[model samples]
Target: MSNPAVSNPAASSRRAARAAVAAPPPRPTSAQASPRPVAALSTRVPLGRRVAKKAFPPAVMLAVASLLVGTSVPANALFDPDAPPASMALSSIADAKVAETVEVEGQVIEAEAASDIATTAASRDAWTVTSYAEMLRLRYGSTNYSYNASGTGPIRWPFPFAAPVTSGFGDRVAPCRGCSSYHRGVDFDAGYGAPVGAIADGIVTAVGRSSSFGYRVEIEHIINGQKVMSLYAHLIDNSSVLTVGAPVVAGEIVGAVGDTGLSTGPHLHLEIHVDSVPVDPFAWLVANAG
Candidate 1:
């Protein structure tokens, strides 16, 4: 009972080899397996990101911030430790400018004040001079001098010198040839150059050279509402300074005594007139010259 296909051993062996060639390979173990190589990790960073990471230094950053904000940094802040800060230096400069401005303003004010003072002083001086001139003008009367005697009160002495009365007014022998038989005025034995003064406030009516009176000055006054005249005669040559129409006050010097003309010696001849009538001058002097 053997089959024909089973009888050949070589054919059987060849079929076995063909079957082995067609079969799948077996899987490898963990230790014997090969690992795939990972792609090399990239180490290079981007240029833009690298530059952004490197920050600026602190000092440079501060300077840049100041420039951007329009703030100034003093040069000394970097170079000099002893120098003032920027704010302090700015403040000092401002203060100096203000001081200079104040000084200039003060100078201007002082100059103006000085000018005003000078002007005021000049004006005051001018006013003073004008007032003094007016006073002088009012005291001296014009030509045709006349005075109203009403309301006038007492008077002063007529002569500045004190001396004895050598001759009395009224009936007296003539001292010189061609002189009058009656005397009209009293005589005082004052040495030459003795000062004579006005007895009362009055206006000078006459000043002249006369043959009988020599150099004489006449002043008309008002006394107790009555008009009167005072006469000073026998004055030294050129000694009379009064002029007609001038004003005179009591105790004001008019002339000096002399022996000119009909005078017997160096003496002063004083006369008083009431309404142009000669009167005793001694009685009037004693009554008023207390």
Candidate 2:
């Protein structure tokens, strides 16, 4: 039985073939086996690129967050709820100053305007007065006028004693040594010591002596808003019963007619003035006497 294993070659060969198929592969020599497939350096490059790709986004995000924190503006600098901005505060002060300046300028302008208006009004008034004066000179041929209060309507006859007219008002040859070339008043031959009365309601303005007409009395009257003056001259000595500023009514006795300065005989010299200009007493009496 032991010799049977050695004596059959074909069987032995078959066993050998089976063992060879069942055995593991032999270790290779250094020269005979290809080097172990080395991982390529390029492959490591892809891995590095992948790692960088994953880390890069986080790094960029962190850097951006830091930049935002560093460059961020403070809320108080632009929009503070408790306090105004510096520029706004300065603007408010500037506006206040401008308003004050405007107010002052407006006041000055108003004052100047008021002054101009007053000046214009005064100039107009002066011109009116001058024109009125010129008109009186042209119409009356004289500038002597007077103001008086003659009752509401027409004037009254001046004499207390009825007398005829002795002399009329107008130009005439010199009647006496001291008489004017042009007669300015009318004369009534009332005889000596005749009672002289006021022509209208008036206040005595003057009581004095004159070289031309002795012992004169002047009374002022207003009639129809016009001023008038009455004159009584050549009065008797110590005959005046009224003083200056005394009120007198029409027909009230003022003095007595007599021969005084510049008179040829005993008479009453009467004159009328409109706004200081002498007018014809006879004409005035004829037109205005009640």
For lDDT, the strongest prediction is: 2
Q: Model 1, 1-290: lDDT tens per residue?
A: 89756898888899899999999898899988987554444566788887766755666898889896565766655687788876566556555555565577555555455455545554665663456435534543222211222223348665543566776666555567876657787787767898887888899998988888898889999987889999999999889888899999887888998877786788889999999899878766665664
Q: lDDT for each of the candidates?
A: 0.74, 0.76
Instruction: Output candidate 2 Cα RMSD.
Output: 29.1
Residue 69 lDDT in model 1?
Answer: 59
lDDT of 2 by residue, 1-290 (tens): 56978889899999999999999999999889786546764456567889999999999999999798768966555665877665556555555555555578555555455455545654665663456535544654542323232423436666633467765676555667777757788888867988888888999998878887799899999976889999999998779979999998888888988888888899999999999999998778767875
- Model 1 pairs whose backbones collide: 149-222
Question: Looking at candidate 1, what is the lDDT of residue 239?
Answer: 96
Query: How many collisions per candidate?
Result: 1, 12
lDDT of 2 at 99: 55
List all candidate RMSDs to the true structure.
Answer: 29.7, 29.1
